[model samples]
Target chain A: MNEIKIFSPATVANVACGFDVLGFCLDSVGDHMVIRKVEKKGIHISHIEGFDLPYETELNVAGVSALAMYNTLDLDFGFEIEIYKKIKPGSGIGSSAASAVGSVFGMNELLGRPFNKTQLTAFAIQGEALASKCEHADNLAPALFGGFTLVKSISPLKILDLPSPDGLYATIIHPQIEIKTSESRAILPTEVPLNKAIEQWANLGSLVHALHTNDFELIGDALNDVIIEPYRSQLIPEFKLVKEAALQAGALGVGISGSGPSIFSLSQGLDTANTVKEAIASVYKNTEIVFEIHVSKINTQGVKILK
Target chain B: MNEIKIFSPATVANVACGFDVLGFCLDSVGDHMVIRKVEKKGIHISHIEGFDLPYETELNVAGVSALAMYNTLDLDFGFEIEIYKKIKPGSGIGSSAASAVGSVFGMNELLGRPFNKTQLTAFAIQGEALASKCEHADNLAPALFGGFTLVKSISPLKILDLPSPDGLYATIIHPQIEIKTSESRAILPTEVPLNKAIEQWANLGSLVHALHTNDFELIGDALNDVIIEPYRSQLIPEFKLVKEAALQAGALGVGISGSGPSIFSLSQGLDTANTVKEAIASVYKNTEIVFEIHVSKINTQGVKILK
Candidate 1:
């Protein structure tokens, strides 16, 4: 097929206790894109809708990622991208990651799947960098490989896909506030107490075990962030109230989604996820903050081809 | 059964990147203890062999642990423990843990098994604190729960049992130098760089995944210590040379076990573990410091009753 239409989903990165290393895909919200072969040589963002984004090839997240992949291959023809952006930018739920992954995923499909998931993630990270200001594969890996993805290392770019337990779901709340990735990152201390770091890694290690064994209680206990959240949570409105509300409503765990103006709660089932969504929204509604919430299952398939 | 004879195996704690939280049991060497019920109402350290350790019930490692557990119960009879210590004290391979585990395990057997593994670990930590100057379940958990254990939380004492992949073996080298756990701990920085902490948790998370999937190559790559080893390895004699030798001889990964003085290398199979033992021994042979080496399989069973 010369043309492909795909659904590139949003993701929750910096998963509690796993800042900059862990993430999972979302099935509840995403962006749709159509990529097709064009007669000319380079790259083009032919059409766009839903959100205002940079149209220039190098300037746009999708265009930049597609260009990165295109540069790797010596292709005769060019490709054109049509975007239907749905996930809001600066929502902290991997809006840029969706845009980035969509481009290369669609192109790789057109190219008869020349690149592997990790390579596609590398290309997607180039685009992701435009948004996050630093190279991180936490969001991109899950967006490409689906389920839970761990960025084992960054230099050589090692990505590990972890299990998504059955019935696991996520409830995300975007409070319609702006928190830049760089700004959020800036507030974090350059150094953390060694004891706190030990606690963080311990939780992260146990979280992986919880996932593999399908232990929801262990997941709840392990989803603690000792180092990053205490600092960054200050930027979000009513962060503590939202987390407490989510947990009180029976969410397995709750934390800031990424570099948030957004927060996410993970629950064992869709029912609890919906409950958690309503719970967090109730907390946000009391405040002056405008918020939107969505409950989605952990997307096991990552970026998918639309019917 | 009024009397129980047991072999409480050694363990490698602070497993590489898993400082203060992770550990695995070993089968090569350990300590044997015979604990019997006495008509007296207090813990008694009746016999001591091999090591010139204190026989006072309160000061002894095994006795302290037995007292901790004994205090939790309202029992009439007390315990008498006879220790035949084989794993050298200050070897950094859970010598204290084995002794700590042995008393409680044998007593629990005589008392018809009252405590769970986590509870057992908690009591053992009391004894372990006497050695490390801190309460750590890293070594104790593995000895009680078997295989690998992650001390997810220290206060509430949460231990998550991790898998032992088939054919996994350990080669431990005790360089016959003294590095007390408290002194080794004192050398580490109170704080760590945020980036280094992130790298640590990333490796630990991946290491957990590797254990579950039985991915040996991933195990090799993920068995890295970014935070603790750099500081503690300085205290060990020829630490760099030993690690290089282990890796050069096909060991999966090498690091200072628990604290320093003893270095451990993990390999994929029995043959590689043996080879790693030889290589590290060769490196130590050139040094003025004396050394001893032992190669053992991953002990899936923590404390075993002598058949």
Candidate 2:
């Protein structure tokens, strides 16, 4: 392992109705890390490109994941990592997930890829726990494997691969606003209403079915979130207006991405995809939260080593 | 238009965790109905065969469904009908569904097949209301379209086709004891614990994924009913012993069939299936009820018209 160049993708956590249990990978919006083996027994970091992200080992999410992977495995080799943070921090997308997944995925290659994708997810989750306290595998699985994925059983962390529906396009609008993950989660009640939870599950079951059979209409109908979204939507300014506009513009379904101010809508074609973006942007008159519109397919590959 | 012969198969409702939303058709065990235009203005019912079924039109489920279909559509066709009941009444396996589907389906042919499958399901549900009070489509959809099916957004009754999983076999043991459907339903609470419902939904989501991907192991893992089964199992005399024995015999999961006096266990293969059947039978040493075992595949077709 002389010079290792690894790429880790961005992830979307708290995926709509799935909350802690479901998510898929996004290929275009992600971060990359290039790590080179060094002679020293300690780690070194550099910010090569993209955003001027934190490079301190303790401050950086990628650095934390990389350090944890090395320490937990008892590896003696030190690494110098260069991160290209394409995903903006606090975007409600798993911005840190790219760092966490990229670091652990890159570190595994440096250690001769001892851990498989599922095992690597655990390492990435360890780093995520540092920030969220709860270890979520929803974002990590998609960040690792891409496509539509379900964390069916979590005790042993059983990962079920879901089919990526054909002719499906995701239109994400990142409204440049600051809503911390903690604050968004804080608005949600510790305990949810019983009837609301059942409806959530029913919708979830239908969603899983729609993904499996690639039924776009069914997928649209099943993307409802009753448990967290109702309470959490209040934290995001213009959430309802944005959602209505996006849907009226031909988005099949729209909801908060992860725990957000960032919102995403599912569309069948690029035309509707573009319409969804413009519709969301029209509502944000107060702040220039730098809304980025992404129209892409489900990324079926999680973490990849570039070189 | 001439002599019309159509088959609507029997279905399994409340499929473990799916309760109201999930059901599938059984190919072998169902009602057989045949309808021919008699050139009259009234439906003349005759030739009722198989099982212990009544010849009276008012008491017959199939006759009721046919009457509803004829009245709702205002079809002016006099029909001669033959009914053969295979799925026994009070067996917990959607017995009334077989008759209800058969009646509407057979009459539709007699009326020149005016309705589509979903439309037919709507008419059949009207017949089911006579028996169950509430309108449920889970049994009717699968009974019409063979294979695993989902009744989603059930108020409007949206039917979805689910993939039939591989390596799945059912070991069903019917203890010849009488338990009325109304009596069984009376024992269940109108409401359930919130957490238990979530667990049920989680299992249901996993079950849908399992069917989509043909994951038999996961199907077994997901065949749990946290709410209805626990309370209803008390009604079945040998529920625990049969379940324990079936699991011991390598069956993946076991639960009450429909409203039970009947117990069914799901297994991976023929060897395990036979063992499961024998295990359930052994527990009824002193009981007067004779146990019958069925080792069968999931019936895709709901009802049939055997000449």
Candidate 3:
């Protein structure tokens, strides 16, 4: 098997109350990458498809992640890569993570799977860091390992795969607008009030407990972000209206996906997910902003090898 | 039944990582309250034993809590209560909570158990507020419900009873020193760094996951307090030394139990709990500060009714 193709799913990070520590994968809308062994000792992007992205190895997340994995192994072999992007960049839906994770996952498979999921995540993070300017596994971990993932600690890179409750569905709306991840992040306050911080942690703890116990009402009650959302939501158009509509349509919770321009809602079943999707779209219907909505179940299978 | 007796166990609040939100009950140390029906229209404390406590129902935590319950129910009858205190107050353990919980639990039983555990916790908090001047249910919730408890929210009172993993043991060291709860609480910073707050919430989320999943190593790694413990540890005698010795003795984690003077360590089994107890005692062997050590399993039965 000298060639391999892998698909990495899009992910939602900072899930409401969990700021930088929690995320989960989406079943659809991701990036596909194909890797083939080369004679040279370095990675190269031989071809690109579906989206306009930098073909330079260092500039691209997929190429950078693949190069990092190859350099770490210090192998005499290399790979030629091709990326078919489906999840658009600047969508705030973990587009970079899909690219980075797909690259390393394909490389690992080509290299006879030398590294475990956690190790693959580290290499993927290195790739993602080149784009995001910081190391965070909230997106990469779920993209690599599938399902809901918790980045417990980033120092030594500890990741825990959390249990996704039954009947959980995701409804996402991507408006045709772009907000840079760096800019969205810069808008946040460096310091939060101590009381709000306490409330945030309490909700976070409750959220985790609710997930484990499968308490839907508790999940709805705990899906509050008292600190980040209040500030970041300003950057997104129609954020409040969309959220209110989603909630009115039976979404258990709704919040901005990643940073902005994209919003996601969680529902208990397929019918509610579709209802939420329509509700979110109805807010943008009369407006000039063009939007796309996707309804999916919680992605249990994260990144997968296609060939 | 006209007369009822109940024992409410002592609890350790905060649990290192979950400040103001998490706590667990202890088995042996508690307060026993006996309540008998009277023809009067109000609650009363007829007798007190083993502690220098006020007989006035309004001033005492036990009496205050019972009175709160009675007032909430608009009861036509009243009860005379007798208290036999075992857990000493101002021990940095939930001594006051034991009293508060014991009184309400006994009254609930004598009233034919009308209110549920969560309702009982609210009454217990009312009782505790008479002493602490604040409503915190970290200790009271665990004492009322037994085992590990998470006070998810204070208003509209949300208490979650967490699972206690098998083989989990607790070792507590109570140095004969008094650190007023108000004083200890006052020493903490009103504002915490956002970075430290993020780290704390991450550890808290991980700790709850560890409890539900029965991951001991994760529990040890996640049982870190970056906010309150640093400042409050100064109030305890040989706090650092005792914590170091506990860790050296194979204890999974060690920190201040509630506020100061009493430090507790969590271990995986009976042997490690005993070893941790001895290691903690060795730190104060030459000092004049008299201390008491108790080692026991996680108390599964919080407050129990004894007829």
The lDDT leader among the candidates is: 1
What is the iRMSD of the candidate numbered 3? 1.0
lDDT of 3: 0.88
lDDT of 2 by residue, A1-307 (tens): 5777766766666566676677877767777778878877756786557777666887776777777777766556688888877888778778778778887787677778898888887777776766566777777788887887777656787777778876677778787778876787667665555446556776888889888777788888888887778888898878899899988998888878888877888888777788887887888755655666777666777677674
Candidate 1 docking classification: high
Would you list the C-alpha lDDT of every candidate in the order shown? 0.91, 0.76, 0.88
Give the i-RMS of model 1 in Å: 0.5
TM-score of 2: 0.90
Number of backbone collisions per candidate: 0, 18, 0
Please report the interface RMSD of model 2 to 1 decimal.
2.9
- Model 2 per-residue lDDT tens digits across residues B1-307: 5665655565666777776677766654556677777767665678877776666665666767777777765555566778766777777777788778877777766556688888888888877877777788777788887677777766767788788866567777778788877788788776666456656777888899988777788888888888778889999897988899999999988887777887878788778888888888888865776877777777655555455
Error of 1 at A139 (Å): 1.0
> What are the RMSDs of all candidates, in order?
1.2, 3.1, 1.6
How much is A21 displaced in model 1, in angstroms?
0.5
Question: Which regions of candidate 3 are displaced past 4 Å?
Answer: B74-76
Better of 1 and 2 by TM-score: 1
Off by over 4 Å in 1: none
2 or 3: which has the higher TM-score? 3
- DockQ each: 0.95, 0.33, 0.69
